[model samples]
Target: MKTKYWTIVVLALLTAMMSVAPASAKPVTVKGKVTAKEDGSVIIGCSVLIKGTRNGTLTDTDGKYAISANTGDTLVFSYIGCITQEKTVKSAKLNVVLQESPEALKESMVTGYTVGESVEDVSSEEIRIMYVPVRQELPSEEYNEIVENGFMKVKDTPLSTFSIDVDAAAYGNMRRYLNKGQLPPADAVRTEELINYFSYDYAKPTGDAPVKITTEVGACPWNPVHRLVRIGLKAREIPTENLPVSNLVFLIDVSGSMYGAERLDLVKSSLKLLVNNLRDKDRVAIVVYSGAAGERLPSTSGSDKQKIKDAIDELEAGGSTAGGAGIELAYKIARKNFVPGGNNRIILCTDGDFNVGISSGKALEKLIEKERETGVFLTVLGYGMGNYKDGKMQVLAEKGNGNHAYIDNLQEANRVLVNEFGATMHTVAKDVKLQVEFNPAQVQAYRLIGYESRLLQDEDFNNDAKDAGEMGAGHTVTAFYEVIPAGVESDYAGKVDELKYQKPEKTVPVSLSKELLTVKLRYKQPDGDSSKRIEITLADDKANKVSVDFHFASAVAMFGQLLRDSDYKGTATYDKIISLAKTGLGKDAKGYKREFIRLVEIAKGLDKE
Candidate 1:
């Protein structure tokens, strides 16, 4: 009877355990490789996630990932610039070849010049007019820096500091991807640049400083729990006649990679337009690099436009790249003809492939940083795609106290070189840095929208030796920060335990009780070493005012956040972004704002697919 009772107890316990367990409780390790279906090439850094769970992992450089899941559990594979896919785990090995999503492939063949069909299929005259080829295009291998800004507690981290970035390359590159019917890589959608690309109407400064500061705060468009803060820095506009004489060196990359008309031919045409805009008081030199660097045209007065045009037209693409040698030689030429108080600059045009020597971006940065002390600026004009090295170009421009632009077509070229000539070539402020201190009493946490690569250590803000971005005349730089109001719970918010050894002080202060945040800016005059400081305080007011520019910039910020799939993009969607952008389509003389609205609409349609 005792043995029978014991057997019954064991049987009952087993029955309960079996009934409670999941139907497919046993888990097996699933392994897979994610490759491009078309080329069978392994995709690096693709995301692999278990369905209905937070468990996920990224593919290694070899595009392989292993995750533990039960039979019938779904697995998802996703990557930027590619379509997302899902599979149920039936067996242990579930390799996947991700086909380019219809959305990514849909608009890719639409080369902005023509609406439909390949350039080769078009009439000969039409093909000649567009200057595009019939050859199949390859995916862009361009690299961009990635930086994610996380929410910071005002008490633990009071100060937010970063270098000011005026480069608008990201904006144009994004346009290229959109036109091709594909979403850009997450790294390619920089919020700050997208916001700063368009001009904003801000009050000019009446003081000694070359830049005026503007600030506005309002309820965030995407997140009701958060508020938006806009900081605008506008450089004083200078008349073209009063601008300094320019000493320009045109550095052209003639490597075989540039043989395509979209590369070398387009560059030549763009340079001609710039040559035509040159003043007789200015000087121009031409340098070409292809396996070796050499002078294409000796320093010639800008008055000799024909000579410059001739040299530009004669450029041919062949041989390997010697970009480092070309850069050094161009700088040497510019220095030899350097004029005091003049706009001395080297304008480097390339796809940014530097193969021969000193090719690494870090080494190139050190070289450019060392050369910039000579008071010469650099202008990086990126041309072509697929092989464009945007990261290297950004580093060179930032370190050399200059600017960067991406030229996709003649229209874009004109926009950068002609429409904004003074702003592109003239530098009014150097090493500009911004630091914001938020009041913990009113704010729970804050995250900068963009400029991840431009983030600087708090101590670096006041350091004169550290390099920052340069501001050009009439150029406006804008940045956005999202703030979570006090009492709001956010995933991005941090929790800290009470200190054992120290006493907790009051959250509010008498002096700064009513203040929202203090914005501090430090910058050096175009040629000065020491820095000048500017401070402005924002009040914590219930009534918030929003401007068209502010709304428009906010829309752009949302667009970037969505592209990057940021965790902080609360309640953001393409339709909402489109609506916000539509509100600001007023007085868009250049149609840039309208263009943004159209892009948003396109993205909306694509997202649905």
Candidate 2:
């Protein structure tokens, strides 16, 4: 009986060994490639999971993925830029591709910024900020810097983007005056400096609508020291039928300077395009400027589109620029035909090189200082090359309570007019300024990135009459601050005497508000510019999803920060920027955002010189 039992045990052991053979070879192999449906970018970091098994692998550097799974198991490939995908393993090798995700728009790119202490904690009240862009490194001190104004035409697109790039940089030798604990240079502080110094006022938007503030801040991809920041605020696009028809006027500058394919000619063609798109209810007027300005055409409705087109066509570049005369006449014509609540505006199309009366930027600004009281908003459309006056245009947009745009070609005209129509005309808020009184206990020393030209005297704020930039319907404004905690301090800027006599300010906490910045908007109806002010605060902490807006804004702000030559831009370049942007690229429905990343890449490549 013992011998028979031993024989049965040996047979059982042989059966167990035969059963373990199948388990030794983990035979489920998985492989696939991940790509986007639109631009065909390889989807990296995508995970491939073998359903019902404990096996998973990520896509390789090339967006091709591999894993091991058993037959009849499901394979899942998941990534950030594309929709999650799944495939059933019918064969040993499984192939997978990803589609673009539709939910990217609702995502935010920026995380929250570490804020600094409130003003009360600081020892100084008089804060002087010096704005500086990264200057190209010169092998020698006197390399002879070159400043030029040029235009760029996109591939297959008629639009030409204007640029006034500076080789903006400074060396230890450049600031000889700033030696031994000296301050920054004055030439570095440009006209755009003071304008960019103070944060403009704005009104906080409500509900699910997003406020878009898009800007580029970097050494001109073409010219290093010359930083370029183009701000595009896209509010929720409103249907044209809901908004009132604009009672428009084309204030064309037929000055001697306005002669060229890039100037008067482009303006004429751009205006003709507008004439064709006018609504029946819209009224039109024309004002031309030369050595003196004149009313080229009186107000007329779109029923006479051909008449306006003919007048626009009749415009010929001649004489010196008499912008002051044109401004006065344009206002007069607008007043005579002003319609309450109608979109009444005189679009100033020029090269911004005003040599006539009130010709200089300050002079032209003062000239229209009182005219804004008439309630007719201004839209300064800059044209021409060589003498492209960005300074004059910025000032007019600020004082006249309007917006400014540089038009390089016809495609740009459509982008400014057709693509960003409501933003071009509709004023949702005006005189927008940003004010952040950080809780000193929570923050320390903070630095605001960019806006070197937008800083303001604390007193300049809350002064209702002070002029500021305007915001369009559905527009969003974004700014960034790199905070250095109060407990710990570094010598970033020059220390001054105000640090001696200053006492820290302390204030009691009131109701938590959503206003991250107190947006004080002062605007008049399209025709009634006596002006009105609306103040709202934007907050971004718990109990307020306000942080949500801050997230998107922060990402953009960080991008701007990464672009500028900030002392803290450690490893913060285009590669990281694309990564962060890819991570937070929210609902990118129209692919404008995808194009933005592409632009970043292209600009990186274009500016490689």
Candidate 3:
């Protein structure tokens, strides 16, 4: 009887305890922000994952993230260049600050061009350029050439001169910042690059000329009273079978700064894709640099794809960046294996962190300029970020007569190296310049939408000695100009006092008055010394008939202006941009246009925030 009573009492006590016990700790929605400990700046794209679970999410542009977790469950936060942290979930809100990884700090010292186990053993000369952030201060080392293209009066400045720019690094880099829920800096928003990033349906070159010029004039979307003129250069597209034999030098950066998986590892993967596109007639050489420069592979036949890929796979990151030395070595190798009447180029992959010998921008430019005289083209592929030297890379690409592309992910790599192989590697024209003569009778003042760094003096257009931009096979370059008609009034366009010393010019002929502008393009053959000129006359009647491409291009230009907060933007609102972009989203075969719409929406939200 006593035992039965005790068992009943124990069962009753256990049931009471079980009834009061929490039910598996009901899932609670946890929200938090991840920021850099150094500066308290929100870290966009920081990874936040539930510990021991597959559920994870990235921080938005504002460094905010949300996850569902149970009491006592842990959450892990990780970011590149920062230490990973784990926190126990006790409340619905938990914020985190990630510190710079100690391991990364210790690995800053470079012993040689090879990966070292310890930084303490590294010598002074072996040290490469690395981001050494001070405690409580994470300095941004990003570079951008400021863009300041002001308004030009037609009577004072009749000729608009600029180099043709096809480099799309700024667009990709801008996408990076936006996708991470942040707005790109003003300097990073290169208006010309953003305009040229997409393909426009323009007529192909049908004549012996390597490129054809296409011009469009349409009502400006931002200010209907004003007008926008677009000049497009379309290079002839050559079939892959007709491409000449290519001699390529892969100049890779393997410095300590490139230690992350996104840096060296992604580069190896990217190169492997390019290797697959090679032919037996193609020859490739591998050059890697850190504290020093070394040749990893000799000029080997592209038929040996496995060998080339293996060499790339074996690459390890460490040491200091010797970008100048590496460029010299790569060019030397390219010259040694120089193929006449064939494609000869050096593809430099780096973060633009040139620390060692000959690291100055001027020195690098001079080196590349001299080597370009040997008929070797340069292709600069920028990788990694957070201390990326965009200005240096731009100079290298400009002076070396090469294209600049920033590869943020594998998809971009595939686009640049594989999908657009011919356009990316094959040159159609070089030293290309555009000069537009606006009719003073039809226009009062004008402002170029972009291409600040590419602007040239009027004399440079006819000067064969002046260096301009290179056009690749099948590449398209576009430029936008905002014009104020003679009758329209704009606060941005300041009127200049009439020149008392010089008499007022006579009125243009009625026939010429009807013409909006004449676009003159000067370009040289890939291996030619002299430039060939092409003139395109745009009429007022033609300006009234615009295509989807014109509207789309105008939308992109307006977006850039809004992003840069340009004084000439007039009334470019995000909603207005979205509506305008939607109407012209023709074909959008690659969905890049649609993607751009989404980006605008994201920007809209971020702007509100």
lDDT of each: 0.80, 0.51, 0.80
lDDT for residue 584 in candidate 2, whole number 0-100? 47
Model 1: lDDT to the true structure: 0.80
Across 1-609, the per-residue lDDT of candidate 1 in tens digits comes to: 999999999999999999988777568988888888888877654667777775666554356778777888888776544677899988899899987653542223232121111111111010000112222344656677686898888877889999999899888878776666678788777778888888888778768998888998999988876889999999978887788999999999999988765688768867776777788999999999989999999889989988888888788999999998999999999999999999999999998999998788888988898899899899999888778888888888988899888876555666777778888999999999999999887888899989898999999999999999998889899998899887888777867778999987756644637688999999999989999999998776856678888888888999989988888888899888988888877687655686677677777777777
TM-score of each: 0.78, 0.56, 0.78
Q: Across residues 1-609, which tens digit of lDDT does each residue of candidate 3 receive?
A: 999999999999999997886666668888888878887777655666677765665564456777777877878776644677899988899999989764542221111111111111111111111211111111464666675688888877888999999999988777766655678888888888888888888899997999988887888899888888888889999887689999999999999988764578668867876887788999999999999999999999989988988798789999999889999999999999999988999999988989999999888888988999999999999877677788899889999888999886555776788768888899989999999998887888888878888989999999999999999889999998888887777776776677889978765635545788899999999889999999988777634578888878888888998998887778899889888888889886555786677678778877899
Q: Rank the candidates by TM-score, best first.
A: 3, 1, 2
Global fold similarity of model 2 (TM-score): 0.56
Q: Which residue pairs of candidate 1 clash?
A: 107-180, 108-180
Give me the displacement of residue 102 in model 1, in angstroms.
26
Which consecutive 10 residues in model 2 have the weakest lDDT in total? 115-124
